[model samples]
Target: MKPIFKLQNRKLIVIFGLFIIAELGIEIGFTFVSARTGFYFVLQFSILMATLFILFLIERSMNRTKQELTKNKQKLQNIFDTLDVAIWSHELSSDTLLITQGIEKLYGYSLEQFYEDKSLWKKVVVPEDMHIIEEREKKLSIGEPITSTYRIVRPDEEHRWILDRGIPIFDAKGNFVDFTSVLFDITHRKESEERYRSLVESLPDMIAVISRGKIDYINPAGFKLVGSSSAAQLIGQPVKAYLPAHVLEQIENEREEKKTFEFMLNRLDGKRIDVEMSAMPILYGGRSAHQVVVRDITQRKKAERTIQFMAYHDSLTELPNRYRFKQHLSRILNSEGDRTVAVMFLDLDRFKIINDTKGHTVGDQLLQKVSQRLQNTVGDEGMVSRQGGDEFIICMEDISKEKAAEVAQRLLDVFTSPIAIDNQEYFVTPSIGIGIYPEDGTDEETLIKHADTAMYLAKERGKNNFQFYSPELLDVSSRKMELEGGLRKALDNQEMILHYQPQVELETGKLVGVEALIRWLHPQNGLIPPAQFIPLAEETGLIVPLGKWVLRQACEQNKAWQDAGFPAIPISVNISVRQMDDEHFLGSVTEALEKTGLAPRYLDLEITESIMQNIERSTDILSRLKELGVRLSMDDFGTGYSSLSYLKHLPIDSIKIDKSFIDDINHPSNQGLMVKSIVDMGRNLNLALIAEGIEKEEQVSFLKRNSCAIGQGYYFSAPVTAEVMRKFLAEGFVSV
Candidate 1:
């Protein structure tokens, strides 16, 4: 290879070096060739072949170079087509430009359209960024390069963020040629940065960056939260100086340990703030910076305290609740002191009547008013708590039984005056029971039980009174319990029977009606009168069923008397308060009338004065019963506290004078005057008058002179069974 390349170069160089020599050589070579073989033409032919071979090699090299150039140009075109960036130039004089195809894809405009007017590129730039773009371009025109990010709007009205770098191309003579620029779509990158900035600024917590122990940056919220004019005022101020001593200690601890901390920070406005701050060390430009977030929790802490208080106190009266009271009771019971403690229980009598007749709104008002009155009456010696509806418990510490009684008496006195609720006057009485410490019982449970027993005893004796727990009271209650058990059995055994006492017309001396009274003819014990057990029956609700039995039996016996051709006198049966208010009272009466086939007029119902006053829903019930054509009489009148106004409104046909007035009829001065006045009042009110307990002739004379319509007592005839009463009625309404 070297030998061939050397021969060619040497021949060419020798020829060029000796052009004259080459010419003489050519002449000599021709003369020699002509002489040797007469071949001058052959020599010329050889020279021509050599020149043609060299031209052929030159043409081959040119073709290969052109093929390589074409390949490289294709590669450059592919690079421009695939690139996301657009490369372009602008000729400022003509305002015509060259833009890559990427410009068409990026701005939704054809490259030809963009190049048609160079100003189109400027117009595509968002108007908000137009001033900045122009200012930057001006900088670039003065031999400076420009690199900026600005928004450009596409044909679809979507805005894109682009990074543009441009430089002015100049000639060697320093004249401006064109603008050479590269544009890159940077919309995603710009959005990420904007999101980060917005999230930091929108936080509710106060966030700050402290570099080198001084404030460097803080969000806008931190300024208002830290009681500062601006971040500038806080900058350069030592972080330790802005915090309290405790907060400073916390911050230093957190910094040393590289941990988060929480504390209270007091602002310049005298407000104490509960803040939890998390601080981290961030490197900024090769220096350490602390980014802290402070959150205020003052309101949350206050709410926690409020919830805690509500759990321990009563919501209505704001007093120690039952839960707390039990805790106190247990503590007192466990103490080793000899101090006396009395637990008194007081229940308001007939409280439910007021609540039922009126409304619960009035009931609530009454409770509030009563609570105030009880608080004022107790003063400060004892604790009065509302045990429940219409019931209260008083705890008097270091008090004897007598002292406890006095306290209970004081409470009872508070209820003496009528209580007004919702413009309605109501009088309520209390039955109180007291149990003393170490005597009644040692523990709270036993003491409460004994107090309850004592309270019931007080109610039995009479309401508006207080009783101390005594052994005798317990014995009497036990006996009464035994009697109740016996009576319940007696009913099943058919030992309970009804007795009738004839009611005679004083003027006619003829039987008008008979009062059917209950008599428990015990198998062993002879007879139990109505006076002895009727009250107990009513209290225990035994009167409802027992009263029904009495009504049916009385109606049947009276009908039998009429069928037997005896006088058709009406029969009266007493109805207790409970029976009158029973839902089945009217049904029971109708059933009895149907069974006995007794007319309603011949079946009279006698209700006591007290029962009439307190019967629940009496207005409609009484009126309905009156519509049934049954006789209604008020028994034991002038004994109960009845309002004359209400009495006149009742659907009663007659008033039976109580036995108390009849018992004292011999003392004419007072008793006679009372009976005369009652009879006159009843007559004037158009109510029939019946004087009961007329045992003496003098009493009969007094009642007859007072114009009493009827009289019945042991003097006329005692309560006898239907068999004995039949014989007596057959004997003209007299005793056999």
Candidate 2:
């Protein structure tokens, strides 16, 4: 297309030329115009047209350049609006503000509003930060670059943190034109700083930061630990002042390797404490430094020491226990002190009886006093240690045979003085056994074993005296160990059997019941009686499982007899106190009856009178048995702590008069009177009275006279096999 400016210029040229020509023509025709006048008009008109067209071309080019500039400016603004940061420019002369769309997103205002209100930036500055903004504005006016962090209150009344960086713009003559600023929302960053500061301040453990070998930061807790009232007191001090010598040397490792360590800290107040610490490299004040965390471990250290002590020492007596004692003895024997050193093993005589009769609390008090006396008697003479239970050991150094005997005698003399405990006076004596080094045995284990054996011998020889261990005692010790091993294998070896003895009614001479007796038929030792292994079982806690086996066998045999069309007589199974105390004793009994298909009534549990010693526990256990429809009998009545007071509280169906009273039936004494009284007691309680050890017919007659109905003794029949009992049942009688 031709230029519109060109077309207009061409028309103006044509008109101007035509007008001039007409003017010339008119002049010639009328001879009224001169040549100078026409020439001047044409030349002036040509000059005017040339100047006008040049102005039109220049105006058109300027308009096109302005449109291109507008398009580029809009594109730049769109790019700036998408940015998260706010960008703005201010004209110095007019105070006019030009801002991107991001300004509205930041301040909740439109760009037009910012332009209309020149003071919008100043108004948004929070009151507290207004001075900072004003100071930065002054910097901008001075053509200086400035950066600042300040709080701004948005139009919606929300406060935000902003980091503003502004650079000054200058004209050609160095006059300030305007300042451009970029603002980044730093609200989240500021909040995170506050939270981090709060956590560091509130920590219980001390935290510190070290920079350039100086303490730059410390938490409040760290200040208190160092006996300082404020961080100012410790900051800028050499880090070595607070750290231990060794830990100070390890600081480099902590920084480079992130090492954690423990040290004994030296406080400013001249006190020492245990501390655990960790250090890692971190940025502090824009410089690489060490950040350390420390924790006070003084109490934890004390607890650790306490646990260590308890592990090796007896808690009750506060004396070195078996483990610690062995350690000391082993060390002494391993060294050169072997010639004259003596190891003495001591035990309190009949301590279990004291515990059971006087109650464990009193027994504990008695043991404490005994331990004190032992300690006093052996003061500076040697070390005394407890070997658990009622047993104790004394190691005497540099003592000859006679001196060792003297020490043992001194120990015995200490126990002669009765000690009072719990408002009651009790006498406790120690049985001491001395095993002299190089004489009794060599090593610690040997010496300790010999001493223990001698202690047992002393007890056998009527306790309260000390005796030296001899080679002869070793034989007995070996036999006892061998017996224990055999007993452990008895159950698995099928070497143990239950023999049932008939219990006959004195009134009708008819068999009424049978008591199950456990006998060990050893492969080589022949028959072993209850007197031998029963006590061992009680001591070793084997009685529980052994008694359970007895119950099972007795229940099965009695059930078999009843199923064979014989009279169902209750078979009594003897339960040791150990079995009664076992947690699963009832469950074992129930399982036995269930497996045997025996009626609960036909299974009788016979407990000794000692069960009444712990009457509360016995009551609870016996009541559970009663609920199972079983009968309970107190075996060996009139023995132990068989107080009639406790007897009335027991859940028993029968009371078995002990053999001792029945054995005295023919004596010319009041023996029958005691039996009759027990019989009368049983009658009053509606309990059956059975006599034990009725070996004579006169004893049976005496029991009949005393109204005791059931009698079991050798006169009827000794403990026999189940088949023999079955034969007796078939005959419906027993023969001596």
Candidate 3:
């Protein structure tokens, strides 16, 4: 407005100068022509012409200036209407207010309404925001520029956030006169800010903003995560106080980019927690900063560690498993420099028998106790691990065969003192086999295999002993494996047959019963002895099916002999410990008798004294057999460590003196005393007595003198096929 005023002033000055020039020209012309004519007449005409010319020029210039002012005012109005803002001014002198049409859009009011009510702008302000308008007016009155934000409610009841920027207009003397202001609507921006604030505040994870080196802002979760009671305790605190120095350096180095890291957070409570923090650059309060989101992962980390431990350790024994043992052995083999490393495979002898008889609960408890003792004995000298079930493997580095033997002896000695379980003491022993590195083989698998083979050898050599790997053991192991493979297929091929040995009445020299024995007629190996493959079958768990086949065959054969018009007599079949431990043993016997139509009294079931280890269960089984009307006999009596106190409780009808005692009767070491004692006991108990392995007449004579009436040995007839035994039965008697 001042520039336009100055331009008008300049134009007015030009007009005055032009009038003066015109007056001067007229006066000079009159002065030159005054001498030739009448001076007064010429002067009057010149004055009139000069006056007309001045009026014409003044009209044109004034009209051009008015057009330009009108054009400028229209341009200013267009600008105000095009923008999303309202431009207005207050006139102090007339107390009048003027505004453009833009006010209608900003405040939802028309120009006429504002003019009718001069205080309409103040009335539209929300009650809570009226102070903003008052403050703006006070600042403007003091000749100051003011920028303020306030809320307003329009006539339509719509609320809006407004930004008012006003500059005070003053006179040349600096007295405040009026003010001009621009009004803008910022409702969308304010709503967005509120939404962002709510989102940050409601998050479960800690959200923090770091500016410079200090914490500029922290959410509620952030305060809780750091164990701070209030925001004041964290805001403006150095981030380094909570984050380690190295972590802070890493954050600083990656400040411009997004990064995630796992670190230990130092809480205000002097405790540390595992946390995962993700940081990224953001603008906060119009300055560059980092926004970090932190999550606690302590529980997840602990769970991961537990899973790792379970992968390599046994659950029940809490010892390293087979995989972990192999890994350790491989590491030692790879790192050692010609040092002897020993891998000893230890198997608890008779564990299956104990487990089957005593219940798996006691077996599990016993295993745990054994593993603990093994570890204590091995100490730091080696690594002891469970190879599943009752098997354990130990790996020792920098050890010789002699040292390994000593270690194995120590392990065996640990079980010397009975393990007390359920208030009962049990003596469990181990069969240990040691295979040395580079001596047995160069690799883990080979060493473990050789050690396993040697362990089987120890069991064969009589359990509760240790054996080192030798080349001869491999041949024995290979042969044993071959026999096991053949044994599995023997029953399927019908290569298995039963042979009967005559059980003679010593007084009459007459056949009273026959003991049935199983033999394998291998196609390639001819007849395989039972001793070579029976243990293999038992160990491989093939005995369950094989024993079933034997029972069926023996029952069927005895019934066939009876159908053939032979003398009626009980046929005895040997039952293994494995068979007795079988839950279906009773069922198998019942099925055999039912299928073969063999009378229960004609079938005699012979059980070894070894079954007495589980005396209560043995008594139950014998009582059930007695209830079936079958004859029960204790085979190999006086050979096993059966308790005499429990023997009377069994429902057995007879006791067979073991062949070992019978073979030793002729010895002079008072060995006959043992047989005499067994015969006397059997008679006193009213149980029939039988002497096995009677190869000489003197042995029979000695047995008959002791009143042991029944005897089965080569002295009468060796075990023979069904036809040969039938011929012997036909003869019906043998000379004593």
What tens-digit string does per-residue lDDT give for candidate 3 at 365-464?
9999999999999999999999998999999999877888899999988888888899866667999998998989999999999999899889989999
lDDT of 2 at 60: 72
Whole-model lDDT per candidate: 0.77, 0.83, 0.86
Residue-wise C-alpha lDDT for candidate 1, range 302-358, written one tens digit per residue: 777767766655555555555665666778878887799998888888666455434
lDDT of 2 by residue, 497-570 (tens): 99989998777668888899999999999999997788888888888878888899889888889999999888
1 or 3, which is superior by TM-score? Answer: 3
* Best model number under lDDT: 3
- Worst window of 10 by summed lDDT in candidate 2: 1-10
Please report how far candidate 2 places residue 646 from its true position, in Å: 14
Q: Which ranges in model 1 have alpha carbons more than 4 Å from their true place? A: 1-106, 117-316, 336-338, 349-362, 377-380, 412-429, 480-484, 498-594, 598-736
| Cα error, candidate 2, residue 491 (Å) | 13
Give the runs in model 3 whose Cα sits over 4 Å from its true position: 1-83, 118-146, 155-157, 166-176, 315-318, 349-369, 417-428, 484-493, 498-519, 523-736
